[model samples]
Target: MAALFLTLLLLSSAAQSAERTLVFAAASMKDAVEAMARAYRERTGNPVVVSVASSGALARQIEAGAPADLFIAANPDWMDYLEDRKLIDVESRTNIAGNTLVVVTGDGAIAPPVDPEPLLRSGRFAMGDPAHVPAGVYTAQALDQLGLWEDLRPMAAFGENVRVAMALAARGDVAFAIVYGSDAELSEDVAVAYIFPPETHAPIVYPAALTANAHEDARDFYAFLRAQAADGALGPYGFTKPAAGSGS
Candidate 1:
């Protein structure tokens, strides 16, 4: 009877150890992070929960006292906002990767304009709402650099987020939409019209942090995300590791 009781206690402890939850991530990271979370759970025997939305919205939610074990943002600005509010563990904050912005059109759509300027002057374009989505800010900057912001502004259809912008382009509602290279890669239904030159806008860095309210298991998962072995996990999702000393 003593041996049986000890075995039951071990099993119970294992079950308890397998439970964990996380929240706060950008909308664009939903697909990749969800897959990563599933893999992490299987490997570590711990479950993970995620909340996805625009980084700006997530930041507002956290500032309003939402419970989040972790936060991953598409831009540094929002992460800095959280740090300033003392909502995240400063030591756990780091820029994990970067991504490119691209202009994409529906597959087999009319060939893209050689110069985006002509397209902007003639037809509708789609982009995320810059006030709320990181991708939109990047797109705005790119257009500004090209001297096309004012001209393109009139034809722009602003989606709630990058995903919505991509959907608009895929549906042929707009000639093209600005979205992350990774997002364009996810759907063969969309064909990339052009890659916004790196010099055209600020680099899009994805920074992650452990929320101050996180449990030990959540912190462990956060650490796992920063491990070198996790590079492969990030690559397929259109992320490239940031240079050492770059995130600071």
Candidate 2:
């Protein structure tokens, strides 16, 4: 009888030790982060949960005391916001990857000029809400740089996020949509119109950090994400390594 009791206690302890849950990332990281989480679980035997949404929205949630263990934002701005508020562990914060902004058109549509100027003159464009989606903010920066923001403003359809912007373009509801290069690759219904010149806007940096509410196992998972082993895992999903001396 004592042996049975001891076995049960040991089993319970093991179960507790193995159990792990974390809000693993941002909406833009849906594809890559999901794959990484699955691989992480299989290799480490720890479960990770992901929350996908606009980086700004996720930041607001974390600030509101959401139980997030880790945050992977599509841009450094939101991560900076969290750090400013002391909601993230400073040592654990790092810019892990970069992405490009691309313009997309629905199936059968004529590709717009590689430069955004012609597209603004041609027809309406779809983009995420600049107030919340980093992709949209980047798009705005690019447009402003091209001196077409005023002209394009009249024809803009704002999506809640990049996915929605892609959807709008995919369904032929808009002439063009600005989104991440990864998003363009995922949707066969949409064709790439143009890739914004990297010089036109600020570099897009995806930063990850350990949240203050993270468990020990969650922190371990976050560290694993930055390891060299994870580099290739992030690339196929349209991420590039951070430039030298770029991340904070």
Candidate 3:
């Protein structure tokens, strides 16, 4: 009888493991994704495991065989990297959401249309590392378009990801930071001081796809993302739904 009970326990454990879906997502999507995961769980009774970090970092991990079933990137570049390497299903890729860049301050007191020049002159400015981070790249482009890059680059403080940059400003480590509007919305310590003109940079879009070796079960979760996004689950978090019929 004891042997039969042990056998039943192991079978149950295996069944549970089989129902788990692993997702690798950019850090900025953390809050929205977690909420989606919970809703999915309530509806499907399947467990979802989420790993959030910089898009660059997560891409490297997936390349190194981290076993992610799906990936949601903050920018199209990282998704392109994986797709180019045949690490993701090209046909499965789709634009999921959109975001805007904003200059933020620690005290939520700074007003809109801020002049970053004077702000950066006396203190450090925080942003993601432009070498690979999307937010940093967008910030660089906007600053260059406004001809502020040459002057502001000197006082720039780099973070591994947008959230880290936002944290720097939120913690008073820097005078200001540029982060996704969604990120600033979630942080009480920070306020949007200025919104970067979309014309100054490439469109900010989030793309999601199944990994090359994605478990068949992961497909359901992938579909859930589309369904939830369509339902405007990300709206309250300050993310815009992808334009209808937009491809990755």
What lDDT tens digits, residue by residue, belong to model 2 across residues 1-248? Answer: 99999999999999888767676466778888778788889998888888788999999999998888899888889999999999999898888888888888885546556555766567888998999899989999999998988778888998878999889988888887899988876677888878899888888888888987778888778777778324566887777776556667
Order of the predicted models by lDDT, top scorer first: 3, 1, 2
TM-score for all predictions?
A: 0.89, 0.92, 0.91
Winner by lDDT? 3
Candidate 2 error regions (>4 Å) = 1-8, 108-114, 228-230
What is the Cα-based lDDT of residue 151 in candidate 1? 78
The most accurate candidate by TM-score is: 2
Q: Could you tell me which residue pairs clash in candidate 1? A: none
Q: lDDT per residue, candidate 1, 1-248, as tens digits?
A: 99999999999989778756776888888877888788878888788998898999998899998888899988888999999989999998888777889888885645656686765565798998899789999999999999999878888998877888999989989888899988887887898878888889888888899888888888888777777325667888777766455574
- Reference-based TM-score, model 3: 0.91
Candidate 1 Cα deviation (angstroms), residue 128: 1.4
Model 1: lDDT to the true structure:
0.83
- The 10 consecutive residues of candidate 1 with the worst lDDT sum are 239-248
Note the Cα lDDT for every prediction shown: 0.83, 0.83, 0.88
